[model samples]
Structure formats: structure tokens, C-alpha cells
Target chain A: MPTQILYKPLTPEQEKRRRQRNIAIALSVAALVAIFYAITLVRLGSNVFLRPD
Target chain B: MSLVSESDLGQQSDFGSAASDASPSDYVALLKPRVMSLSIFTAFAGMLMAPHPVHPMIGAIALLAIAVGAGASGALNMWYDSDIDRLMARTANRPIPAGRMARGEALAFGLVLSAFAVLTLGLAANWLAGGLLAFTIFYYVVVYTMWLKRSTPQNIVIGGAAGALPPMVGYAAAAGSLDLSSLLLFTLIFVWTPPHFWSLALVKAGDYGRAGVPMAPNVWGPDATRLQILLYSLLLAPIGALPWILGYAGPVYGAIACLGGLGMILGGWAVFSRREGDLARKTAMRNFGFSILYLFTLFAVLVVERLTTIWLGA
Candidate 1:
């Protein structure tokens, strides 16, 4: 059997802030992904099509 | 029988309950977004003025990295200076000092972002720019915040170098090497920093004294700080015109630089001469405000000149 987990309940304010933080982290990760994609495209340029199989 | 120790419980409580209240904006506040904006502007100007063209996407990414790097240093600064920050009225409301964020949280945030920023810049641009950004972060966090700020009056004087380096980093990102033009931009900000900061320090001497940070005015007395401000202003005036004299910039930029330099000199003289009461405070405040506009105007002029030259082939 799995050991019982324990956690403290967050205050309403704390819960809201935590939600905001999670959203921010999600947005930042998305932005990072977008940046990486853009940079790869820019760096590859026309050469991306010329890649040998 | 309790499985957790008292110390472990304490740690968990501090990290979990308190941390949950720190919003993303508080994290952004740790980044010192205003300072980051200035760095971004100067870095963008540097990129525009580079001898070679930069791919727009690459340049954007490089700027983003520089901005992130600047923010990282700021977070580290807030982390290290949290104790003193609580003592100063101006800085007392900062995220760390205000109890919105924990110091360890800030430190981890700074270090992680710093690593990400440096690595991203190195990959997105060239390593030279990345290296410069890394050094800048180190200089601001280690040399300026951790060491000089507490040790000597000349902290801002020497520490100014870190703040002055974004443009050079941007130029390197674009051209992959340093140039006289880039160095001149660095020099302009370098010379402009003292009067810009000292004027504010004159007003905030009490705050510095309370915090035990040896700002020039607090340590050297207001008169010496005023004189130093004037001296730096005099130096800054000519340095501002260097780009124009060197012929990289056209007459428009030269005119703005000269007029702006004159404005600085006049502002410096006002601060120097009026050293008595409310008038003194007003002058110093005026100088402090104008000095920001002075640097911004100079860089903005350069950016416009470069853009016009690129578009019109002038």
C-alpha cells in the first residue's frame, strides 16, 4: 500500500496567487518554446530545405 | 511519533505557505523591469548601429536574452540587498523587502534565469555577446551588489560599468566584435552615471546612511558629491558629442548631443550652485530626472539615425 500523503490547505489568497504563478509559468514555457522555434527557423533559413535525408 | 523534525517543519511551512502568496508580478518586480527596459533600449540601439546587419529574429532573441540577463542580475541584487533594502524608504517596498518573496526563492530564480539567459544568448547570437552578458551579470551581482555597495563610496562609480555594457553586448551580438562606436556608447553611459546617480544620492543620503551603504554623498559629504557631479557632467558633455565628432552620426544627432550635453551642464551647475534648502533638493531632483532623459535622448537619436541610414541609404 502507498504511504498516506499530507498537505496543508492553502488560504484563498494563497490559492489565487498559486494559480497566477502557474499561469505565468505556463506562459513563460510557451514563450520559450516559441522563441526556440523562431530561432531555429531563422538560423536554418533556406538551408533547412536542403537537409539530406 | 513525529516523522518530521522541527526544523524540517519550519522549512516546509516557510517555503510552502509563504511562497504560495508570491504572485508572478512579484517575480517580475524582482527582475526590476524598469532597469531591464533601459538595457533593452540601449542594446537595441547597439544592435541597430552594428557594422553588419543582424537577422531580425536573431536580434529579437538576443535582446530578449539580454533583457532576461539584466533581470536576473536585478533579482540577485534584490536577494543580496534585501536586508539593507528594508532600511531604505525607496527600496523598502521591493518584493523581497516587502515580504512578498523569500530570499532563497529570489536567489534560485536569479541563478536559473541567469543560466538560461546566458546559454540562450550564446546559442541565439554569438558566444562573444553571450560572454559579455555573463560578465555583466557577474559584475552587477558580485562586484557591484555583493562587494562594492557595502564597502566604499565609489560603488556606483565603479559599479556603473555593469549598467553601461548592454549596448556593447548588443553590438557584439550583431557584429560578433567590439567597435569604437559601441565603446563610445559605453563611455557615454559610463560618464553619465555619476551625475545621474549622485544627484539622487544627494537627496537619498539619509536613506543610504541608514542602510549603511556608502553612497558618494553619504560618505564624501554633499559638497564633494556635488563637485564630482559637476566634473562628471563636464566630462559627459564632450563624450556625448564623440559619436558626432567621429562622423558615425550625422548633423541631427550632433545637434541633439550638443544641446543635450549643454542641458546636462546646466543641470549640473544648478545642482552645484543651489546647495542650501528646498531649492537644493529641487535642483538635485531636476538633475536626476533630466539625466535619465539625457541618456535616453542620446541613444534614441543614435537609433533613429541608424534606422534612417538603413532605410534611406543616406
Candidate 2:
């Protein structure tokens, strides 16, 4: 076998594919954090932006 | 002159070099995402029904920890069972057995996830949650993977404890302690697992027997295991209804629990009615398919009721 670590570093096309996945995971995790924070804001009985006192 | 000679063929799989693309989905497969999803959903339901409130931030983190903990167990399971997994067609395509990821990588991933999950649950939730998470890992890896599976006919029966702990972990995450309701959730899954898995074993008996896996159907014979399935399903009905009987849920949830469990009974009966072979395989497949939905629907009803109570302040 080509050295296990060296059995073809991913071709450029594969690297680009991997890059897209990396971006998706990063975006998803970041969006998850933001969504959870918003849920917390609402779950705690906060609708401040929508309320007019 | 063929490019693929005997010498080249010998070199193909040396030291985990394989042709499969190792993409993000492959790593997600390493997490056993279906199992993680079930664990997360059930645990979240337990948290919702617990006595004390959890901060939503902490709740999300706690759920993530539980999901990670379940994933760690899965990775470890894949590591240990890769041998049998390769032998069985149903599991042959998994990340480890299919050689999509190296055994060493899977092992390290599991260990790291194990540590991170337990420690984070402890900090974000409570020691009880953390402790339960740790024990779940040990139970799945040590008890199910190492001891009971290969050694005993009642492997899944006795080893179902690890699979049943998710709700308890979730309950403790919210309340910082255990309660009868959560333990009831634990017991329900525990009772449900034997019948659930035995149904699968019914259909896969040949594969298991080929792998020398000592499944109940292979060792104890199909008729006995099918009867055992009926007996457990018979037992599961009453206990499955305990939450509503205990008064945590209203009639809507109670009726659904009863009916869903009754569906399992009918499915088990369908298996019980058949003689072993393709006939029994079809029946067992019915039972196996319904069992997953049965548990999910039962829990889903509980969640729906909880959300309704919160919405209407019922």
C-alpha cells in the first residue's frame, strides 16, 4: 500500500469538497449557538423587542 | 499485463489504506448518529419533565454532552465489535468494519469524546448527570461489548441497562438528582430492549450464528426467543403505562402509551404465531420495525403533552 498516511493526499477536487464540508459544519455549529441563545432569550419570558410598554 | 496483479492486490489494504472517500458523513457515521439522535430526544424529554428548571444554554450543552456520550459509546462499540460486525451483513457497512476509518482513529475519537462528554456534563449539569453518563459508557463498552454479548444468551436482556440510562441522565441534568418518574423511564426502555433486539435477532439469526455471536435465537432456538419476546411485550404494556398512572401525564398521553404498547404486543404476537423461517422473518421484521416507532411515539406523546401544558399552563 502507499504509506497509510500517504495513500494520496486528497486530490484538489476532494480537498475542495472537504473544504465545503468544513465550512458547513462551522456554519451549522455557529448558527446552533445563536439559535440556542435566542431560544434562551424567549424561554426566559423575554420578548422585549416586540413589546411596547 | 494487468495493472492489478497478485502482488498489488496484497498491498491494497495494508495498514488501513483503502479506496473509500473519508468524508464528514463517514465521521458522523462513526458517531452512530441515529442512536445519538434517539438518546438526545429522549433525554431532552426527561429534562423537560423534571421538577426543576434548567437554563436553556446549560440545557443545550447538557444535551450536546449526552449526544457526545452516546456517540462515544457507539465508537467504542464499533471498535470492539468490528470483528463480528464484519461477519454480519447488516453491520458490515459500518465505518470501522467497512474500513472507512482506522480502528486507532475510532478508538481515540471514542476516548476523547468520552472524557469531554462526562466532564462537560459534570460542569454544565450536575455530578449525577456526569456520573450516569460515565456509567452508561462503561456499561455499553465493558458490559455489553466485552462481557455479556459473547458470553451469554441473555446478553441484550441483562446489558440493556446502558441503553436505558439516557432519560435518567437527562432528568438528573435538570433536577440534579434522580426521581421515580425518570427511573420509570429507564425501566420502560430496559424492558422494551429485549423484545426490540430479539426481533432483530430473529431476522438475523443466520448472520449471528455464522459470526458465533450467541444470539438467543441461535442458542436458545427461535420458538423460545419468540415466546420470550411475547412475554416481555406482555410485561412492557403495564410498566409502559406507569407514567400516566403515576399522574405526571394526562389522559391523552396515557391512551397513546397504552395503544402504542398494544401495537407492540400485536406485532410480537404476529411473530409468536409464526414458525421460524421466512415466515417468522417477516413477522419479526414487523415487530422490529414497530418497536422503534412504538417507543418514539410513546415518548413523543409525552413530549407533546408537556409542551401543551407549558403553552396553556394546564
Candidate 3:
């Protein structure tokens, strides 16, 4: 038979912390994507494919 | 709903609450940030050592992709090894085993990150780096964590390849291919791994034995493991000097490598000479600590040498 595991609900403080942490992670991921795109723009503008003779 | 029993309602509530309990940090913990950092640093060194120049942005992207791929492997390893992880005191508090994150959630997270890292790296850099990253993830998760870890004493010997590949991947990212220098870097890490990991295995042999993992000290006797560590250290010391001997690194790097190599040998000797209770454990711990410092110092010196050359235009 499968084991029955009990779960406890988070306290208010824990729940608040979780929400804040999630928000931070979302913001960080967004920032990384933005940085990547910004760099891509700079690379394209600089003529990445052209080589100096 | 009308026919549902109270027990069923309780079980449903428990399951729902479990999802809410996982914090973002718990998810980040799944990534094994420390291991990711080491891999990133080594990869960065490889990039800097390569003859070809990479744009700063592209280098950053390649590094980020590699870091993400490493994290994906860590998460998958944790998910699969949760059973043994719970058994070991050192790993018992990890997010998965601690119930902060569900195993299924970790598995899905790892898979998604693995795919994303490979695809993005292929687009940003070249396919070689991307392919290496994908293979590294597969090797760590499938070959190391799932297969070798439980099955043999030589687990770390083979599994170390995954850890050793990041520099080569970074070299490929910057140069668009690999060469002898990158292979030397890979070999250095590969040879260094056994002595580095075995010291910890010696200290944690009981935990491994209890978990039914065939770590070196348990499979081979402690005396034999100690001797093997010393032997590997002997090989590693000379190999550590090869970059300088090969004309890639400067005199400063050569000096540090020589000193670090000696330190590793001394640490190994201490472990080999002393094999009693507390003294033996202390010696093993010292070797473990010194091994980390040795690798870090060697890599740092390489970075410094490269930066100096670049600054001097020599």
C-alpha cells in the first residue's frame, strides 16, 4: 500500500516569504533575458560578422 | 463531491498545501549553486585561455547557458538521489529530501532548464558548446547519478568526466572548436577528481556504506584508497605543471602550480601515513580542503596570467 503522508499549511509569515521569493526569482529571470537581448542588439549594431583585414 | 469521504478531503488538502510550501529559494537550492559556480569559473578560464576572441556579450551568454545546464544536472541528480541523499546527513536537508520541493517538480524543472540552456547556447554560440552541455547533463544524470553511483566503486572515476567537461565546452564556445590546451584542462580536472573526492569519501565512508553506495573506502579498504589517492596525487602533480611546460602559462603560473602540486602531495602523504581513527579523519579532511584550494589557485593563476598577457599585449 502507498504511504499516507500528512502536510502542514504554511504560517502567514512563511507564506509571505514564499511570495516574496517567487517575485524575486521572476524579476531576476526577466533581468537576465533583458540583458541578453540588449547585448544581442549591441552585437548586431557593431557588425559582428565583419572582419578587419 | 457528495460521495467523497473525510479522509479523501484531507488527502486533497494536504496535496494542495504541499505546492504552496515550496519557496523560490527552495527551487534555487535545487540548482546546486556552488557546483554551478565552480563549473562557471572553470568554463570562464577555458574561454579566456582560447586563442580566439569572443564578444563580451556572447561570452556572458555562453557562461549563463553553461551555468544553467550545470544547475539542471544538479536538480536531476538530486531528484534521483533523494533516497540516498536522505540517508546521508550532509545531504538530508536538501530541498527535495526535506520536502520543500516535490521530486516531480524538480524533475520537470531540470528537464526544462536543460532544454532551454542547450537551445539558447546553440543559438548564441555554436552547436559544439551546446552539444557538449547537453551531453554533460545526460552524463551526470543518467550515467553518474542513476547508473554508476549505485553500481560500482569506480563511480566517481567515471562520473568525474561530467564535471571535467565544462572547460572544454567553454573553449568550444569561444574558439568554435577544441584543441590540445582544452584537452589538457579537461585532463587536469579529470586526474584531480579522484584525490579530491576520495578524501571526502574516506570521512563519509560510513554514511555511504549505510546508504549502500560503493564508495572507494567502502569497496576497497581505507588503506588501499589512501594509497590510490597518493598515486593519483603523484600523477596530478606533474600534470598540473604541463601548461607551463607546454608554453601556455607564464613563470608565475608555473611557480604556483609547483607549490600547489607539492601541497596536494603533502596532503595525500598525510592521509596515507595516518590511518587510525580521529587522526585519519582529520588528515582526510585536510586533503579534501587542500585539494579545493589547489584547483582554485591553479585556475586563478591561469586567469591572472592571461589577463596580464592581454593587458601587456605580449
Candidate 4:
């Protein structure tokens, strides 16, 4: 026999908190991406646009 | 789909755990933002005092990574010490202790941030600074928090090195190496930490005692702790003036360091002599307050002098 899965519903407060955590995580990831992009550009400097044929 | 048992599900929610009630602020609290801010300030001073001018962008990111690393250590500390934290009134309201968040969550958060902060710092700045930041986090989490905090009275003395490294890391981030000047900044904070913390420990011995943490005032008697505070204060005075004596800082810093060092010695003396009832607590509190002002004033003077020279093209 296959194992049964149980589902439980979240209260309104729990849902709201979960939403907040998700949003915060999303924003933090976005900020990290921006930081990486900025560091790459600054480190590459004038060489950023250069490529050898 | 298989049939589900309500008993297996019980009261558990699909959306969250016991930490479900945690808000963003709770997570911020886990980071210990106040301590993080102090690290950032001192690191900025160290960066400014360095000979080489880092690209503004690199400096900003390096500071950010250092701040995040400091926060990660604080989070890890809270995670490991949640039990003792719950026992102490001072730390009772912290997220894990207050039941707003779970210890596992804090541990995961801390570990993830630590990796990110160290790696980003290495890529943004140099590996030397990144290595120092990694050592700081590791020393604080493993040596200070796990090994020493509960086991010894000298916890903060050895652990203070972790706190003192911010300026060294900042200097390395900018200069790509350490100097006597950077080491002096580290030493200033390192020597200052014992007296600074012991004063508060004197005031909060009861809390630390209850938590079973062997703070100086609790492990050694309060009188011994007081004497130790005075001794450290005596050492801190000259060390605080070293930047000026070594010719790295201006006379303004020398004057301020002398005055502030005098104040610190006086505060230490007050705490030392006033060993009775309300007077002792009051003196300890006063010393605690002055120590903060003392370090901040010294660093502020250094930063201002650096900026002045930079601006005047000196």
C-alpha cells in the first residue's frame, strides 16, 4: 500500500507571515544579484567592453 | 492519491512551523543589529585610515559583507545559546528564546549568511580580508560561543579578539595588508573589551549566574572582577593613545585619548572603590556607559582627522 499524505490548512496569521518571509527572501536575493552585478562591472572597469577578434 | 489520516496531520500547518509567527523584524533581531552597527562603524574607520583609497563601490560592498558576517555570528550565537538565553532576563526576549523563531531556522540562517558573506567578501576585495572575516566568524561561533562562554570567566577576554578584528579586516580590505596602525586599532578594542564587559557583568551578575555562564563577576567574586576591570582600564589607557604616539593620528586624538583614558581610569576607580550596595551598581553602570563613549570618541576623532587630511590635501 502507498503511504498516505496528510494536508493541513494555515491560519490567516500564518499565511500572512509566510507571505512576508517570501517577500523578504525575494528582495534579499534581488539585492544579492545587484551586488554581484555591481562588483563585476567595477572589477572589469575599462576591460568590460573589450574582446579580442 | 492515498487516503490521509487527520491524526497524522494533527495541529501542524502546511504553511509554517512554530516559527510561523516570526516577522521580518524577528529575523533582524536574530542578526543583533546593534552589535552589527558597531562593527560597521569601526570597520569604516579602519578603512578610512588605510593608506590606499579603495574604489567606493568595493569599500561599500566590503563593509556590507563584514556587517552581514558579524550578524551571522550573532545569529549563530543566539542559536547555540537559546537555552541559556531563555533562562536569562536580558536575553529572554530574543527570537528563539521568546518562541518567535526556531533554533534550527536561526542556525540555517546563520550558516547560509556566513558562507555568502565570506565568499562575496573574497570576490569583492582580497582573500586576506575575506580570510580574516571567516576567522572572526569561526572564532566567535566555535571558540567563544561554544567552547568558552559557558565554561570560563575569561570568555570575553579571548572572545574579544573576534570583535576586535573588524578594523583589521577593514584595513586589509583597503590596503591589502596589515600595519602597526591597524593592529593598534584592534588592540585598542581588544584591551577595552574586558573592562567594558566586566563592568556590565558586575551589574548583571545575577542574570549571568542564573544562566550558568561563568562571567567574571560571577566566577570570580565581584571584588576580583572590579580589580580586573581597573587593571584592564590601566592597560587600555596607553593602548588607546598609541595611534597618536606612533604618529599615525593627530594631537587632537592624543588629547582626546588622554582625557578619555583619564575618564576611563576614573570610572574604573569609582567602580573599584564603591563596593557597597547601590553605589557599586551605580558606579558599574556609569563605567559601562563611559566605556562606550570612550571608544566611540577615539574612533570618531581618528576618522575626522583622516577626513580632514584627505580634504586639505595634507
What value of lDDT does candidate 2 attain over all alpha carbons? 0.84
Identify the runs in model 3 with alpha carbons over 4 angstroms from their true place. A1-14, A46-53, B2-18
- Candidate 4: how many backbone clashes? 0
RMSD of 1: 2.9
List the candidate 4 regions with Cα displacement exceeding 4 Å.
A1-5, B1-19
lDDT of 3 by residue, B272-310 (tens): 999998999999999999999999999999988887877
Each prediction's TM-score against the native? 0.95, 0.84, 0.90, 0.95
What tens digits encode model 4's per-residue C-alpha lDDT throughout B21-76?
A: 78888889989999999899999989987996789999999999999999999999
Per-prediction DockQ: 0.38, 0.11, 0.18, 0.50
RMSD of 3: 4.4
Q: How does model 2 score on DockQ? A: 0.11
Provide the lDDT at B218 for model 3. 99
Candidate 2 chain B weakest ten by summed lDDT: B11-20
- Model 3: CAPRI class: incorrect
CA displacement after TM-score superposition, residue B221 of candidate 2 (Å): 0.4
**Model 1 chain B lowest lDDT segment of ten:** B7-16
Query: For every model in order, what is the number of clashing pairs?
Result: 0, 0, 0, 0
Better of 1 and 4 by lDDT: 4
Residue pairs in steric clash, candidate 1?
Answer: none
What is the descending lDDT order? 4, 1, 3, 2
Highest-DockQ candidate: 4
Using lDDT as the measure, the top candidate is 4
Please write out the lDDT profile of model 2 over residues A1-53, one tens digit for every residue.
43333234455755765676577669857865665565456455545456565
